[model samples]
Target: MTTHSPHPVRPGHGLTVADAMDPCDYQIADDSTVDQADNILRSAHIDYLVVRDHNGRCEGLVTRTGLHPFLTGSWYTERTAVSTTTHQRGPFAWPSMGLSLAAIAMRVKRLAVWPVVDDDGYLLGVLTASRAAGVLDAVTTP
Candidate 1:
């Protein structure tokens, strides 16, 4: 079944990235195996996993696509680390960012899920492309 944002976003309105982001509940250790990350992505029906370091800090992101080779290639039996497949460690949004700008960045970068972080670089949540487009369709739609 498909889901959508309940409310539509209007540019120039008071809406913010916080309004469109979902909580950061799902995560995987950087040292985790590619197979492990794949299992979580499949089970959770999510495209990405927030990779965390030993100290529990947000490290980077690992996508199902990143693990595809390991899952299907000769390395399927190998315990490839999730960190090796992770990306997007530096680009993240803040709660106060305008939805318009966030949407633009996601579009330009072709990001399926953009991480949202707090002032101290702690993860707050993620801005999914589907959710952002659903609500901010007006802004993105010509």
Candidate 2:
């Protein structure tokens, strides 16, 4: 996953998280039912969903693994909140963060999806590993 920038794109050369992040359509209300969250996850074909609070602020993230318990047997009939499935509260990135730095942070955090948020903790989008790799490819390729 090593990428050598083609030009002189230094650490703070202006390439940022916003440049590589995609619109976060995979978001669910914190109070949403597990079934509803599961439906969105299935429809979006994403690994996880960002759980937002009433103010549309990022509360945490819910992965499919977290919802597994509720998806099977009698639990499926019960009302489970998406927030209950969320474990990671943050390590969120700012839009102005340098892309390469953000990529490194993502690696260190072992995160496949990095939520990009504003100062107020509102989720702007997600910077997926694939997307970051794509940007690196574009920058490093001849």
Candidate 3:
């Protein structure tokens, strides 16, 4: 599903990235296997995973494409190790951030997925490229 912006995002809409970020949809534990991550991505139909540690703190993110090397090669059996080493850190946005700023950060960082965190760094949800585009479309549409 896509989120529609209420109106055209203007220079002074005062809307923050948190306002546009989708609810938390993807989640996985630190110890979860690569296969498990892959299954979640397939089932959820999303490309990112919000990795949490034992205390449920945000650790990082792992993408579907990032697991390809470990899933299809002579080192396929090395899934566990690959997952442990390749966990990518999730980028963050505060609730007060502007949509324009968030969009710029995503683009400049080449991030397909970014996470929303609270003051304590608690994982709130994710902001994906596709979802962001949807918001843009909604806001720009009459």
Candidate 4:
């Protein structure tokens, strides 16, 4: 059996990752307190935070929904465990990937966002559902 790589998106379509992605820097160290993560998320007004390990490599993602139960209605505290609040590592994509296809896949998987990492797993940025929607809208709007 044989498999082949998918073709890259070309320029004529007016579809590209940069068209949808915003350069972002919301990250929290894995060992950091839940309070720290919450502060970053809230202050940035973003729904998710890229979790980084001690060496500052992308580890996983922490979302508002994942942290809500711990941060509300009585369990709220500065010392809540970041470990327990994280949604462990999931799929990631490369930066050059086309926005529309990536967005569709993420939506199908129910992922609000996904990380874009280099070959060495260094964090580049993210492809968010909102951004993807914008990309779809821009392409389909004509």
Worst 10-residue lDDT window, candidate 1: 7-16
Best by lDDT: 2
Model 2 root mean square deviation, Cα atoms: 6.0
Question: Model 4's lDDT to the true fold?
Answer: 0.76
Once fitted onto the true fold, the runs of candidate 3 whose alpha carbons sit more than 4 angstroms away are 1-13, 78-85, 133-142
Write down the lDDT of every candidate, Cα atoms only.
0.81, 0.83, 0.75, 0.76
Off by over 4 Å in 4: 1-19, 72-81
Instruction: Quote each prediction's TM-score.
Output: 0.79, 0.81, 0.77, 0.74
Better of 1 and 3 by TM-score: 1
Model 2 lDDT vs. the true structure?
A: 0.83
Lowest summed lDDT window (length 10), candidate 4: 9-18
Per-model tally of clashing residue pairs: 0, 0, 0, 0
- lDDT score, candidate 4, position 3: 75
- Writing each residue's lDDT as its tens digit, candidate 3 over 15-69 gives 5677678887678888788888888899889877888877887887888878877
Candidate that beats the other on TM-score, 1 or 4, i.e. the better one: 1
Q: What digit string (tens of lDDT, one per residue) describes model 4 on residues 1-142?
A: 9977598644325565655666657888777778788888888898888888777778889988887777775857677667667475855766777777788788888887788877778788788888888767766666
For each of the candidates, the C-alpha root-mean-square deviation to the true structure, in angstroms, is 8.7, 6.0, 7.2, 5.9
